[model samples]
Target: MKTDPKQTLYGMSVQELQEAVKAIGLPAFRGVQLGDWIYKKNVLEWTEIKNFSKADIEKLAANYDLRSLDGSEASFSKGLESTKGLFKARDGHFLESVLISQRDRQTVCLSTQMGCKMACSFCASGKAKFLRNLTAGEIVEQVAWIQRKTEKRISNIVFMGMGEPLDNFDATMKAIEILIADWGFQLGGRRVTVSTSGITPKIIEFVERVDGRVRLSVSLHSSKPDVRDELMPINRRYNIDNLIQTLTEVHSKLKREITFEYTLIENINDSEEEARGVVKISLPLNAKVNLIPYNPIREMAAVYKTPSKERIERFTKILMDAGIHVTLRKTAGREIDAACGQLRLDREAVSAAGEPRTKNHEPREPAS
Candidate 1:
């Protein structure tokens, strides 16, 4: 894609980088040098890379963005518990990437699009209008930027940040390849989990692509058709029943880590009926359930509420009783941007308050 001239080199494979360099008046061998600088060295600024002359840096930067986080910005929660980086696409739209730390694990929840089209009621991402799909490079850059700032190695990658991963199919897959390849981030497929709002066809395509190496998570807020349709607008197109039926198609083929990310809303979907409904859907496929009690989005505060402790425990007990493995997700980082798309919303709020912000700045040339 970088051969297209307009495309950036941030997400290109070593081969593509080589071809891209040769196409832009540089030797093919420069691709090896460039790849090492971007992926291995994890350089986020062009000027910081060594062994390149100022003239060559200009030639390379002209065609491809050498660094991923050139003009990105970050906001961290108190105690540095969670951090979010708002990345600016070339066209000037913004997307978010969140870094979460658990005992020994550093997980980066990455986004695939500018804003979500899924429009799930409990989410903060859809509050902003959908812009466009993020390029593979942009998706990969989130990790580099987040890792650089926090100085922690990312142990796991989750696509549960903002956008639906399957909607941006090709780019998401390309980004995954760059993430898992030995020449790239070098993480295994199991370390990366792709979450979706149940795009059936694309989900099937995804599992097949990686041969079920990468984990899959579906946003199944409710098991009932009407409730699911209301929570996730995408369900109206691909109903929950049909979506699970679609999962059954590939479940046996690879038997990968299939998870149902159920966000329990107070009175909305925390009842006994809802819990039973979840077992019925997950039983046959052996899919695990990750229970995320709804994190109230400030803009939609009146719309949803987190379930009480007793209710949450009851909800989890029902699923476990049915012999389904379940994980109850604890909410982290509340004081400073607890929700997924809130950081971008925070920046928006700042801008709306008439504060001057700069996301796009002139690239500094490398010194001689």
Candidate 2:
């Protein structure tokens, strides 16, 4: 099937809009006006452009198709708490996004790529290996799709879904820009965060460009070099020292507190000394630690066990006593593979007898 040329709306930046208007026999300044309407107005339909003449809207609509990534499949939490799902692209590649509704806020966790290259031991996203990155339009479409179904407007976004935001750095940042642009979603940059699995160089790249406007969450799953190297294979490439140096540079430049996500696995990295070591290595960056109890993943289930709630609380207290800011993040949507790296598009790749095979999970609910 031929992809729509009008899909240009997804990847177009402000300047590109100016060029587009001129090419379509319209005034260059009209591009700026149209951009303000489409992005700032958050209109997904070309007819929503009131400033343009009816003919102008017709021409644009004929050339470009404003697309939305509707929820193809949805799985809610056991009791209607959270929902997760695979949002299919026009090309049939599935990327994961979750709508998490809390009493105070509604946050959408979006994926930037079809699959992931960073094969962290505990994440299911890496199981299918890397696929192509999603365009900025594709990224933003996930939010628009979810907004239509929920009673509340999405208040925040987290780039902590299937793929590494930094791995698909260009598209990821563009999507963020679209979300925060005065002519776009108008969400504050501070409300949207991009989590990385230690893509060291990209961390610096993000810090420099963001000007302390956006939030950064680094996946620091382990403190020991060898353990981290084993748990997250990306560590072997970026390692801990180099990662620390880059993070320190970011902290120095931005003077912003970084968030370190430590997924505690039973008998893995949840000891008192391990918590102390986390503080020792992380203090230089003035980072806050987010202790995550391990979510049972298909591949890592045999090798890892979720730390008990008592253990998680004790570990968090150790950091707090050391004057470190810490929060033990309660796992959301546990009934439906709610872990950061648990969204994989392998539902049909199981055994045929219909007795659910436990490889990862036998297709749990999405967007719970």
Candidate 3:
């Protein structure tokens, strides 16, 4: 068995930081100083800390590596103003993060895993092979990198990028801790949303663990069991009925609104019947349905087309008439292949073909 390398200092909790300081023959107070520099100050390099002596700084640098995003591979959406950043992990695997700016709100979408295992037919993230789970530090670094680069406070965070967040349970929760900690990013729990593809057991565990402090969203593309099973493979294990039941229990216990992400894939799950099903499921759980018109992927574009505006309106009207709260999400960042896993796939393809990586802003084809 091969031993893993030491953990990065960026993502450790304050308590963990204290332990790290103890290991280095430093006073426990030094850990708090380290936490402040890394989390609150968002310093990417060890040398940025001024409180530590030069010898202490050098000693710290020897034991830990500062992992941050590669600015060279970052891409910005032309009209939308959304930015997609590619961070190369220490192991040389690349992960992607997106900074989405809409008017006053600045939201950063973070990936919990290098690639996704959930084979959602509509998502490009699942098209690539599942690589490995990102550690807590790696996840936190995504937000820190965006904050440092754009100089904008991230108002909201959504685990809606490249992977199923619930699948990477520990790291995701630990990252949340760093985000919500006073000495860290200091974001409110409500500002952070963890979206999952109906991971039943994990959802229950999340509710129990977090006590519904953070916001939750379910990727419920289709309400019909057969259609859902076809679109999201995880639905087979945690079916729609059970998922709804779990969410309903959570809503009753917490009295909070849950978000149901419904991706309208042309005629597939856009039918009025599916809309009715969405209303049925949402009403019971005090959930609001977010209607997303599908972003056409190159591989699945021939099979699936974005639903016409008319179709989307009709579906929204049906849900609204049924006394369900619904919002039609405007698709953004499509011009830059802003969909999850697309930028990584493009880079991988270019590397495999022995072509120089293009840094031009021209959008590759959409994924998801």
Candidate 4:
């Protein structure tokens, strides 16, 4: 297919890749073959795509990049369970994708963009300067990158890493499509969750586009509109009312109950009123609240501490008493700067300073 010479083919679905190759005069079946090579075989090079002539591969290469592990690096935590991968895009900027392994699940959280512009004060990724939204291929390749690290197949995919998944709407949705397609990653929609910081319209649009296959997680740090406004600037724009209304309307199409991810920052949002407010949000949409003990980013450490266990318990009790399902998320990967965008930030800082960030396998210091 006549494509942007700069475009990457790694993330395309069998249908799209077929069209791309067919557009360029390749046999239609080559798309299926390419899909097998990329998704099934996890091929890193076009040369690895056999049966096609070297010249034919070169022709395909002119219009697209294979986007293997090249120009990328990773840092693993001490146990080898958690890994933070930094993939350098064609533009030379790096983006983050994390592997968080616990119990039976090897979940890989993907970044939809290079850096983020969401500006959530408590999050490392949101604090970053916005670069650009990653292409669908770039987004999907994050999984393939993490997949190469371990033998266990990834159990889940979360758009909970660096950027606001909703903000990069098209690429995020396309990536999800590629991930869930049998010709691609073949992951069930239930295993993929797209977390948004309350972008109401996109929420509805995403619901319709995915048709309730993938899970939807909303970051409801505080149920109070005013407090949420302060915590997530996005709330100021979408607000609580708009979000609830949108989700309620979209409820008819959702395949699974929604999950509201609550970051429990000490004193900041752990009040009894906040817990009740979470109940209010959860009950209407048949949602469950996942209480996250806020992982403090060093830059915001003094202001945003994880609440004490007592306070977390008290908060969880409120939801439990209300019969609203909730789970307290365990903190992970502190040593490797497992917080979203922390590694990319460190990688860029070290590169800018002309030094290495850390010795291999050892966790590096997070941003100050």
Which stretches of candidate 4 lie above 4 Å from their native place? 1-5, 23-25, 358-368
lDDT of each: 0.82, 0.77, 0.84, 0.83
Error of 2 at 330 (Å): 1.8
Question: What is the overall TM-score of model 1 with all chains considered together?
Answer: 0.91
Positional deviation of residue 345's Cα in model 4 after best superposition, in angstroms:
0.9
Across 154-206, the per-residue lDDT of candidate 2 in tens digits comes to: 88999989888998988998999988877678898888988999989889989
Better of 1 and 2 by lDDT: 1
Which lDDT value does model 4 have at 145? Answer: 67
User: RMSD of each candidate?
Assistant: 4.5, 3.8, 3.3, 3.6
Error of 3 at 219 (Å): 0.6
- Model 4: what TM-score? 0.92
For 76-122, candidate 4 gives per-residue lDDT tens digits of: 77677688877776555778888888888999999987778779889
Candidate 1 positional error at 334, Å: 2.0
TM-score order, best first, reads: 3, 4, 1, 2
Better of 2 and 3 by lDDT: 3
Q: Which prediction has the highest TM-score against the true structure?
A: 3
